[model samples]
Target: MNRFTTMRILRNIVLLLTVLTNIGCDQISKDMVRKHISYYEHISVVRHHFTLTNVENTGAFLSLGNEWPSPVREILLVVLPIIALIAGLAVILFKQGLSALFRLGASCVIGGGIGNIIDRAVRGSVTDFLHLKFGIFQTGIFNLADVSIMVGTFLVMYSFYKDRNPSPKLPA
Candidate 1:
């Protein structure tokens, strides 16, 4: 194998491992929460501001589509995400010339997305428990998958920010 080919293979392996690690973390955390927290139960993990609450979400982010009709909800929440995730995975794997940061972000996004999809497909809902409130700023109850998604989003955005400004051009 040529040096270039070998490096390509190594990069692919690293990306796969990163994705699997993210997914594993998400699934394990959810499993732990499922085993310990009863339905609709609340546990204060960090005083009043930060609490753990068990709740199942059957809708899109922040329960936006929770009230949608069943058929619509299924197509929008489940089918669309599966399709998008597949497309994203293809881009991450096959798309070349991407920076390492971009790959990391894509992997996290895909891993987290798949984790939630597994729950929705098998349990008919996504398990969410972590809750946070800081005065006027409050986050909807979320899970590890949510955190992964957010971190991935930030990484992706950061990559863009860094790439947008190539070092200031100086006159030759």
Candidate 2:
């Protein structure tokens, strides 16, 4: 194979590996939490600030549609996310001139989406365990998949910003 063809093959492999790695980490952490932690049994990780607890979210982020009917839940949470994830994977895999950072961010998003979708499809909910609170600042319970999605979104946005407003070059 030509050099360019070889490089393209390597890039595709790396992209697939990155997505799988994210999904694996997310699933592994959730599995550990499910096996070891009981529902609502809070274990303090940092005094009252960080905690480990198990809770299954039956809807989207922050349990937004938990009260919705079963059909709506399935469509919104499982079906739609699966479709979006597929499109995201295709974009990262085939889009030309995409920077490494952008591709990584998109892969992370797709991976995290798959993780949550797997839970929703098989378990009827997504497992969430970690929590944080500090004085007036606090956050809802979440898992590694949520972290991956948030970080990936931030990275993707940052990449776009950088592209639009690149740093000035210093005199050579």
Candidate 3:
């Protein structure tokens, strides 16, 4: 194989590996939480600062559409997300000129989306089991998939910013 062909093959393998790793971590954490923690049963992980509790969210983030009608919920939550994830995967895999960091971020977003989609499809809800409270700051109960998505979003934004405002080169 030519050098370009070999590099492309290697890149594809790395992309798939990163995405699968994110999905695996999310699924494993959720499985552990489901097996060990009962719904709403809070267990302190770090004094009053952090806690673990199980919740099955049938809606999007923060349970925003939990009360929506069945058809709307299905279309918005499952169908739309599936379509978006497919497009995201295509972009990361095919789009040229994307930095490694950008591709990694996009892969993470897709991976997390797949993880939650699996839960929603198989279990009819997404399992969330971690919460944090520090002084005046508090967070809704969340899971590893949510963390992946948030971190991925941050990385993607940072990538764009870095590209736009690149550092000046020092005199050689």
Candidate 4:
């Protein structure tokens, strides 16, 4: 095979592996949570700081806009993910020569989005388990897919920051 063909094959393989790994992680974590924890039950893992709790979220983060009618909820929860996945795939395919960090970030976002989309489509809800609490403040319950997306977002932000301000060098 020509060099271009070989490189393309390698890139595809890498992307596939990245996607599979993310999806697998999300699924396994959700499975474990479902098996071990009861819904709405909280198990403190770290002394009022962190907990493993089971929550089925029918809507998006923090259960936002959940009071909508059933059809609207389904469209917002299910159809939107499908659209985002398609858009993300298009960007991944058409955008070329992106920095390595940006590519990694895009892969992660796509992977996590696909994972959650699968859950929402098949289960009618997203399984969230992790819970963090400190003092009187508490963050929303989230799952592995959420973690992946958050990391991807940070990576994208970092890449943009680096691009805008390339590192300065010391005098030799």
Candidate 5:
């Protein structure tokens, strides 16, 4: 195969791998939480720092806007991810000037979003286990998919920052 063909094939494979890895990690962590922890039960892994607390979030991040009716919630949670995935794929295909870091970040975000959407569609909730706490401060329970999304977002932000033009030099 020609070099271009080979590179295209490799990129496709990498994208597939990223999606599969995100899905697999999310599913496996959920399974582990289901098997090991009863719902609402908290097991402290570190004193006032971290814990495994099983939770099922029916709405989006930190259970925000959860008061919506079931139908609306499902549509918002599941349909939005599908739309985002399509848009992300389009950006990957057409945004030739996008850096590799941006592409990777987009892939990761899409993959994680799809994974959570799958859980919400099939189970009516997203499984969450990791919990963080310090002094009087605490973070909501999250899962592997959430971690992937956060990391992807950070990378995307970093890429954008790096690509920004430096301030024009004042005649020195």
Candidate 6:
């Protein structure tokens, strides 16, 4: 294969690996939580700073649309995200001329998105169980999928910032 072909193949492999790894991590942890934790019961992980509390969220982030009428919530939470995740995967897999960081970020986002989408499709809700608080900085219970999203968001943001303000290359 030519140099260009080899590089493209490598990129594809790397992207696929990143995507699968994140998805696997999220799904496995969620499965463990589902099997072990009981609803509304929590075990403190850090002496009041962090805990695991089983919750099945039928809505979006922080249970945003949970109170909405069923049909509306279903369409908004289930159908729309499926469409969005498909579009995102298309971008990550098909779009060319993207940087390594861009592909990594996109893969991470898409991976976690698919993991949660699977839960919503099969279970009718997403599982969440990690809670944290540092003094007054509290957070809604979340899972590895949420953490993946946050990491992916930061990576994407960093990619944009770096692209906009690239550093000068030193001479050899």
lDDT for 78 in candidate 4 is: 80
lDDT of 3 at 64: 86
RMSD, candidate 2, Å: 0.9
Regions more than 4 Å wrong, model 1 = 168-172
Question: What local lDDT does model 5 show for residue 11?
Answer: 76
Q: List runs of model 5 lying over 4 Å from the truth.
A: 165-172
Error of 1 at 27 (Å): 1.2
Error of 1 at 165 (Å): 1.0
**How does model 4 fare in lDDT?**
0.84
lDDT of 2 at 43: 96
Give a tens-digit lDDT track for model 3, residues 40-114.
Answer: 999998997999999999998999899999889888999999999999998888888899889888888888999
lDDT for residue 89 in candidate 4, whole number 0-100: 63
Compose the digit string of candidate 5's lDDT tens values, residues 47-151. 759999888899899897578998889678888778878888778755567787887887788778888888898898999999998889988889999999998
Give the C-alpha lDDT of model 5. Answer: 0.84
Candidate models: Cα lDDT each = 0.88, 0.92, 0.92, 0.84, 0.84, 0.88
Q: What TM value does model 1 have?
A: 0.93
Instruction: Give the CA lDDT, 0 to 100, for residue 31 in model 6.
Output: 92
The per-prediction CA RMSD against the true structure, in angstroms, equals 1.8, 0.9, 0.9, 1.8, 3.0, 1.5
Those runs of model 4 whose alpha carbons end farther than 4 Å from true positions after fitting are 169-172
With a 3 Å backbone cut-off (N, CA, C), the pairs that clash in candidate 1 are none
Q: What lDDT tens digits, residue by residue, belong to model 1 across residues 76-124?
A: 8789999999999888888888888988998888889988998888888
TM-score of each: 0.93, 0.97, 0.97, 0.89, 0.89, 0.93
lDDT of 6 by residue, 1-172 (tens): 8998898878888888888898899999999998998997899988999999899998889989889998998788888988998888778777887777887888888888888888888898999999999997999989898898889988998999999998999999
Off by over 4 Å in 6: 169-172
